[model samples]
Target: MSSTTSNIKFNRRDFLRTSSLAGGGLLIGFNLFTACKPNAKPPVDLADLNYKDFNAFIKIAKNGAVTIFSPNPEIGQGVKTSMPMIIAEELDVAWDNVYVQQGDLDTENYTRQVAGGSQSIRFGWDALRQTGATAKQMLLNAAAAKWGVDVNELSVSEGIISNKAGETLGYGDVVEEAALLEVPGEVTLKDPKDYKIIGTDRKNVDIDKITTGKPLFGIDYKTEGMVYASVLRPPAFGQELESYDASDAKAVPGVIDVIEIGDKAKKLLAGEKVNWTAQLSPSAKVVVIAENTWAAMEGKKAVKAQWKFASPPESTEFHDKKLTELLDGKEFTTLRKDGDVQKAFAQADKVIERTYESPFLPHNCMEPMNFFAHVTDEKIHLVGPVQTPEDAANTVAELLGRDVADIHLEMTRMGGGFGRRLYGDFVYEAAEIADTLRKPVKMVSSREDDMTTGVYRPAIKYRIKAAIKNGELTGYYLKEAAINGNMYGLIPNFFPAGAVENYQVDVAKYDSNITTGAWRAPYTNFLAYAEQSFFDELAEEMGADKVQLRLDLLEKVKGTTDERIQYSPERMQGVIKKVVEKSGWGKQPEGTYQGFVAYYCHNTHVAEVADVQLENGVPVVKKVTCVVDCGIVVNPLGALNQIEGGIIDGIGHSMYGNYAFKEGMPEAKNYDRYRLIRMKEAPKVETYFMENELSPTGLGEPTLPPAGGAVANAIKAATGKRVYKQPFIQYDEIWKVAEKPVLG
Candidate 1:
C-alpha cells in the first residue's frame, strides 16, 4: 500500500534550520540541493566523507553502502539496529550493505528522542519509513531520467534499479543525480507483504563491539587529561550537609581537589519549571577530584563530612502504615468512574477484597551512573549513557547557565537503564563539577552510590475489590496508594474499565522525602499481579475457569464505554487463547501447577502462563509461555530476545527483588545486600507472537506486566496460599521460621 508525506527540502541549511527530518511533523516544501558541489562524487570509504549536520536519516556511498543513523538512545532496547532497519527496508537496500550509526542529540531533527517508555520504535515508525521511501523515490527519479523512462516503469530491489528494457544501475551510480533532484511531494511505501528486511531477523549492529568488550558504554568513555570525580552526598533523604573537611582527601595520592556542590532545590521550587524536576539529589555533596578513578574513590572515602536532619526521615514501616491508613480512609481522588461502584458492591452476593503491596525498586542498571563533561567558556561537551539526552542537555544548559546550543551531548550505549537513566541528575552532576573546576571531569558513581542515591520506583499498595452477584462478575474497584504519584496516567482506561458495569479507579498518594520515579513498566508491573491474582480468586469463587472467565469479561467489554480503551478486547482474547494453547493450560502433567494472566499496557496486549513445581515444598517457576499481540513484529529475533528478557526480568524481580528504606536511607546499598533474580532461578520462557498486519506497538514493557501476575498465581496454585507482597521469597523465609519454631 502507498503512504504519503508532506513535501520537504534536502539542502543542508534547511535540513539543519527547519529540520525537514522531524518525524511525525508536517513538511512544508520539497526542494533539492541547489548548490551541490559541482562535481561531488560519493566517497570510496566512510573515512573520506565530511560530517554533515543534516544527513539525519540515510547516507549512501558509491559502492552501494548505506549508513542509517538511529535517532534514539540505545538502552539495549535494540532500536539502534531495529530503527535503522526500517529505513533500510524502505530505502530498498540490502541488509548486508547497510551500516547503522547512533545519531547525535539533534532535537531539531528528531522528535521524542528519549529512550524511556519503550516508545522509540513506535514513535519513529512512520517517519523512519517515509525517510527511506523518500530517498528511494528520489533515486528512482534519477534512474528514470537517465533511462528516459517513467519512474513507474522501473523497479528496484536491494539498491539496484532495473528498467523495463532490462538495463540496471546501482543506486550509488545515481545518488549524485538524486541528490540534485527535487524530493517527491509524497512517496509510496512498500506493502507489508512485500517487506523483506523488516520482519526478518537481523543481529544487533553493535553485537560484535559489545561482545568483544569495545568502549561502547558510558563507563568506557575517557579522554586525555580528563580528571575523575567521586562524590559523597547526604546519607539520608531529609539530611542536609553541614560541613566537610577535605584535608585528608587532598593529601591522598593523585587527589587534586575537593569541592562542595550546593543544592538546587530552592531555585527549582521558586515556580521555575525546568523539565521533570532535576534536583533528585537536592542536598549538598562533596566531590573528590583526582587524577584517576581509584584515587578519586579513595579520596572520597577519606573525606570527613557531617550531616544534620532537615526534616523527619521516613522508613518502610512508616510507609506501610501510611499506605494502609490511606487505603482504609476515604480521602482519594477519583481517577475514573464508570458506574455506581458503591451500590454494586453493596448489592453483590460476594465481595472479594485483596490488597497487594510492592516495595521500592531500584533500577540497578548494570552500569553505574557516570558521565564525562568538559565545560569551557565557549562550549560544553557532555558524553554519557542517558535515556533522555535532550533533557540532559537542556538541564545542564540551565544548570551551567549556558545556552542549550552550547551544550553538545553524545549518548553512549548503556549497560542497562530500566528507566533509571531517564533522569538527568547524573548528567547535571558531571556538568556541574566540570563547570565548577573549569576543567574536563568525568563523574562516576560507585555501586553503593548508584543504589542508595538513585531515583526509585515508588513503593505502592494496590487494594483491588471485585463484586460478584448471582455467579456473574458485577463490579471492580482499584484503589492505589503510592509514595508520591498515582497510576492514573498509565492504566486508568485499561481492561475491566470497559468490561465491568460498575468500575472505578481511585488514587491517593503520601508525600515523602524519598525520591521515586519510573521503573521499567512502572505501576502496571505490580498492578497486573494484583488485578490478575484477584481475578483468579474471583474465578475460583464463581467456580469458573480462569482463562474462560477473562475471555467472558472481554466479550462483555464491547460497546460498554465511551472512553478510549487502550486495549482491543479481540487482541487481548487472542493472546489469551494462544497462551492457553501453547501452555496446555488446564492439561498440565501432575505436579505442574500453572497460572494465567492477560494484560494490556504500553499500547500492547499480552498473556502469560507460568508453570510452577515444588522443590522441597518450595514453589519454583519452571517455565513460562508468553503470547503477545503488539501488531506486526519488526524483527522476530529482536522481539523474541525482548520477550524472553522481559519474562525473566519480571519473574526474577517478582521472586527476589526487594529494596526498602529505614529512616529515609536505603537499606540495601550494594549487590551484597540487594537481591536480584539469579540466572539459575530464571524460568525457561516459551514465546509466541500473534500474527497480524496491525501497526507495531511497544514490546519492552508490555510483556513485563503480565509476567509477575502469572508467576504469582502459579505460586498460589503450587502452595495453596496467597502472596500479596512483593519479593515472594519473604514468604519462603517466613515459612522456614514457622516450620522450625516447634522442632527446636
Candidate 2:
C-alpha cells in the first residue's frame, strides 16, 4: 500500500473481501489508490468515500473464473475495464474469463476512488499491476510447495502451472493454498512485450449489460420500501426559505409527505457540533415524498413556498454586461510575468489584441442528478451515481453529526458525471428527507431544477495581446476574467508561456452569488480555443502553416533554459508531426477546409484536425483526424473511443453550448434553450495513438482541449472570419464580421 492510504483508518469492512478471497476462491486486495485532492470537484471525483481496508483488488474462483473489483466509479471513461486489464495482463490470466465488479466506497481500502480529472488509469497503474504480479507469485509458491519443487522450475500459463515432465495443476486447484501464503512486498511484473490482453482491443465490462437494457445507472437503481422524493428550489441565488405551504402538496394523490428540507436539515443537525464544509441545505427548497417518481414530481409541481432574498451587491442585471464592465476594474491579480513585455511590443512590427469569452454551461448528465439514501438513527446507507463518494460521505457525516464510520457510501455506474455529481448536494438532501420520513428514499432532480440550480461551469473571459516582430513571435500578454478569476486544472505558464521571450499573465475577478466549478478541462476548455485560434491567425500573418508554426515553437523551446518550462518539447513536437502527417495538414480534399490544434495536459499530448465545409451558411464539420500520445495504451479500443468522444464533446460544447444569468436567475432553463451537438451535427472522427513504452495517462480529457480550437479554426478557414466568442450562434452573420459581441 502507498504511504498516503495509510492515513485512512482501515475498518473490518475493507478487509471483509479478504475473507472471501482465501475462502472458496482466491481474492487478493492490493494497495488503495488515493489520487484525488481533499477539496477538488468538477471533473475530479471528490466523493469522500469512507470505507476501510479495501486495499485489495483481485479474486480467483474455484471454477477458473477471475473477478476484479474496480474501486473507482465508472463515469463512462472505461476505468472499470482498463484497470482490471492491467492486473490480468500482469497476472497472465485469460482475458475471456476475467469478470469485473464495482467496489463500494471504501476510502481506507481505496484511495480517492472518485472518477474525475481522468486520473483513474494513471494513478491505479502501479498498484493494480502489483496486485496481479504479487498474486501470481503467491500462486506459484503454492504450486511449488504442493509439488515439492523449486518455484523457478515451474512454468505458468493462463492460470495453470506445470513442470517440464507435464505434471500440472490448475490455478483454482492451488488458489486455496496460495491464499494462506504471506503476500510478497515485491514481485516481478510482465514486460510490455509479453502483454497479450493490454494493448489489444477489449470490450467494456458492462457492454453486455448496457446494450441489453440492464440497470447500471443511478436512475436505474432501486431498493425495497424506497419512495421517490423530489424538491422545489428557490428562485435565485442568495435566497432563504421563509415558510412553505405544504397543504396543497400533501393533498395531491399518492403524495406521502411535503416537508421543508431546511427544517429537516435543521432538526437533523440540531444543537450538534455539525459544520459541513458546504451548505448542506439547498438554496431554498421544499421536498416532496410520494409512492413513486411520478407522484413525487406531481406533488412537487403542486407545492409553493415563500422566499426571503437578501439584496445582492452590484448593479447586476445581465451577466455578460456586468462581467465585461468589471473586466477593466482595478481588482486584478498577477499570476505570471516575464521579461519586458512593453519593450518587446514597442520593438514589434505589428501588434494584435483580442478577447474571447465562454459562457456558463450545465453538466447536463444524461441521468439527472439522483441518489438513494436510507438514514437511520444508527447508520446512514447511501447509493447513487456520484463522482465523489468519499467527499459525499464525509459531507453527509458532517451534516448529520455522525461519524464517518457510521455512514456507508456506494456508487453505481454513472449515466455521466462531467463533474456535477461531485458535490453530492443531492445526496445530502436525500439523506435529510429519509431521516425526516424515517424511510428509505431516492431523490431525483428535475431537468429544470438540475440545470437552474447547478454549480455551472464558470463563465470566463480571456484577453490576449501579442507582438510579432519581423515575422516572428516576440511577446505575449494575457488577462483572464471570471467570477472569481481562478484558473482550475490549467496552468497559466503551461506550454507557450515558457516558450515566449517576453510573457505575462494576469487575472481579474468579479465576485457573484452564483456558484461555479470545474467543467471538463476547466481553464483549458476555453484557453485552447483562444490560444490555439490566435496561433492560427498568427500562422497566417507569418505565411506559415498552422501545424508547422507550433512545431517551430516546440523546436525553439527545447533548447531554452527557462526555469518555468515543464513539458518535453520532443514529445510535443512528436505529436504535432504525427498529426500533421496523418491529417495531411494542407492537402485535404477540395472544399474540405481543415483546422488544426495541439495541446498537452494530464501528461498526455493530443493534436486534432477538423475538416469542414460551409453547408447552407453553417459550418458542417465532415471529419476529424486525431493523434494521441498518452503513453502505453492500456486498452487500445477504450482509449480510442474516449478520444473520439472527447473531440465530439469539445466541438459540440464550443459551438452550441452557452448559458447566461438575468436578475440572478439562469436564463437557459433547459436544453430547449441551451444546446448540445446532435448526431447530424457530429463529425466522423478518427483516432490514432503513438507507440511508446511510457506509463499510461487517462484519456478522458486530453483530446477535448484542442477540439474546439480545431473546429473554430476550420470555421475560420471556410468563412474567412474568426469567432472571438463561443456558441457561434448566428451562422450567416458570425462569418461576416469578427468583433467583440455587444453585451446586453
Candidate 3:
C-alpha cells in the first residue's frame, strides 16, 4: 500500500541493447531486445506483474498498443469501458490506442476479483491508476535517458514523448528500454483536472461486437466436442423428485448417458454436508450427459417424473403473515434510540402511525444462470457470465478435488447481473455435470428453471411511528421484519449500527420452504421506501415541508458522531440541496404533482424529485430530477445512465412487479405475467451530480431506493390517499378517482 518513486538512470549502452530493427524501423519488445543493447543489463522486472497480487497485467506492445487485463466481470454496467478509461487516463494514452483483455482465473496474481455491490469503479480507482502510472514513469525514464534530457522536461501524450528541443519518440521505441529499468516504488498519478478521457461519454468497448451479434456472452462460448446438459428439478419449492422414468428420455436424439446427481454427491464434493433436516425436502435427482442444449431440453420435457411436495401449501403464506405479526411485537433489536419514545408520544399533540409491506422479488437477469465447463484428467476450464468469478473458481476447484491451479475460469460480459450473479450455485452445477460426464458440458437454465430454483429477495413488513407537536418533529420509531436473508451476513448489523434514535429494527425468520438471496439494493430497497414514505406522511400531518423536516432531523446527526451511522450527513445534504434547486421544489405546475425523497447507501447519497400526472387514471411519471454525490464522478455519462436505468427499473418494481406464491409455487412466470416498464412507459429523467473532492463511491444501487418513495409520495400529494403496499394504486382505481371530477 506504500507509494514510492525513484529516479531511474539509464546509460547509452542500455538503450542500444533494447532496440531492434523491424521493417526499416526499430521494433522493441522490452524483454526480448534488452539482451542485444550495448551496455545491456539482465532484463529487469520493471513492472512487477506479480506485485501484491496484481489483478491484471499492463503491457506496452512494440506498436504502442497499450493492452490492459481487466479482472472484474463486466455485465453492462460499463466496467469493460469505464475501467479502461482509468488506465488510459493515468497512462497518458489516447482512448483509441488502448485495448482491454479479460483476465483469466489467476488467483496467484489476482485475488478478490468478484464484481458486485457496484464496487468496480471504486476498487479500480487506485489499483489500475497506480499500474498505468508506474508503466508511464518507466517509459518516460527510458525516453529521457535516450534523449539525454531531464525526465521532468519530457512530456508524454498519446503514447509519445516530446522534449522542449522538439525531439520526440513513440512509446513503442522506448518500451524495451523502459522494460529493462527497475520498477518505480511509486509513480506520480495524474490529477483529475489533467484527465482527457475520463468524465467524457465514451462508446462501450464491446458495443460493436455486441451490436453485430458476436459471441460475447457465456451462451455463445463453444468448444470442440462440447456437449450441453440440463437438470430437471421439482416444480414446487419443497418438492423432491421421488422417482423418474428416464427410459424414454434415453431414447431421445443425442442422448449420451443418464446419471443421477444427488445431494449426497453434491455434499461430498462441495465439502459441506447436506443438512437434510434443513432442506424443504430431498434434493432433486438430476439426469446428466447430453448432446446439445436443445436435445437435453427436449428429453427433459418428455421424461416422466414423480415429485413429492413435502412442504405445506401455506409455507410462503405463513412466512408472509409472520412478518406482519412481528411488526406488532414489542420485543425487538434497538437500531437507534434517543429520548423515550413512549413519553414523547404521550406528550405529542398528534401521533401518526402507519405500516407498509413489500413483496418478494426475483432478480430475473437477462442472461439466465449458465456455466460452461471443460473438465479433463489434468485441468478444468470454466467460463461464464458470473458476478463472483473468483468465488466460483474456488468452489469448482475444491469440488473437483483438484488443485486451484488446474482450474481456469473466464468471465464473459453478462447480459445483466443485478446481484443475481453473486451466487455460485450455477457454477457448481455445471462443474458437477462436466465431471460426471467426463467431457466439456454447458449447463443452461431455462427461464422457468431460473425463476423457480431457490433464491429470491425476501418479503418485508415495516411499521413506522412519528410523534409531532406544534408542526415540529419530536420523536420517531421504525420497526422492520423479514426473513433472515443476508447472503454475506451483513444485514443483522446494518441498520442497528447507526443514524437514527429511538429506532427499533428487528428481523425474524419464519422457517419456510423457499430460499432467498440478494436482489438489487437488498434491504435498502424496502427500507428507504418505507422510511421515506413514512417521512412524507409525517410531514403532511405536521404541516411541514418534507425536505425541511429531513434537513432539520439530519442536522442533529450531520457529523460522524456515532459509529453506527456509516453515512455522511454533508453528502446527504449536498444531494438534497442540489435536487431541490434543480427541480424547483417550491414551484407548482398546473396538473402536475411532485414529491421528493433522499437516501444514502453504498457510500453514495442520492436525492430525487418525481413529477407525475394521471393519464386516464394511470400514473404517468413525466420526469424525475435526480441529484447524487458519489464523490468524484468517473464517467459522467455512465453514471447518469446508471441513475436513469435504476430509476426506471425501480419504478417498474414499485408499481407493477410482484412475485407471489400459490400452493408453494411462484405465480408469475415471465415478462408476460411479470410486468416491466417498457420504453413508452419510461419517464423523462434528469440527473445532476454534486461537486466534491472526495474519492468516488458507488452509483448503481443508490438511486433505486428513492424512486418508489418519491412516486408514492407524489401520488399521496395528488390524491388524499396513502399507498402502504407495492403496486398499491392500480390504473383502474386511479381512473375511477379521476373520472369523478369535482364540480365547483
lDDT of 1 by residue, 1-744 (tens): 334343433543343222122221112111212212334322111111121212246767665677777767899889988988888888888999988888789766654466766665665666567677877888899899988899999999999999888899998777667766665756777888899998999998999999999999999999988999998988899998888899999999999999987555345545375667375455778999999999999999999999998999999999999999999999999878888989999999999898888889999888999999999999999999998787778778777667898988888999999988878888888888898898889999999889998899888899999899999988999999999974356567888878888999999999988878878886788888889988998899999988899899999877655646767888998998988899999899999999899998887899999999988776788999999988878988999989898888888788778888998899888877777877898888898899987778788888888888898888778778878888777533522442111000
- Cα-based RMSD of candidate 3: 7.5
Q: What is the lDDT of residue 739 in candidate 3?
A: 26
Q: Looking at model 3, how many pairs of residues clash?
A: 16
TM for candidate 2 is 0.91
Q: How far is candidate 2 from the true structure (C-alpha RMSD, Å)?
A: 4.9
Backbone clashes, each candidate: 0, 21, 16
lDDT at 586, model 1: 83
Q: How accurate is candidate 3 locally (lDDT)?
A: 0.71
Q: Pick the candidate with the highest TM-score.
A: 1
What TM-score, over all chains together, does every model reach?
Answer: 0.92, 0.91, 0.88
RMSD of each: 7.1, 4.9, 7.5
Worst 10 residues of 2 by lDDT: 1-10
Once model 2 is optimally superposed onto the true structure by TM-score, how far is the C-alpha of residue 729 displaced, in angstroms?
2.5
Consecutive 10-residue window with the lowest summed lDDT within model 3: 42-51
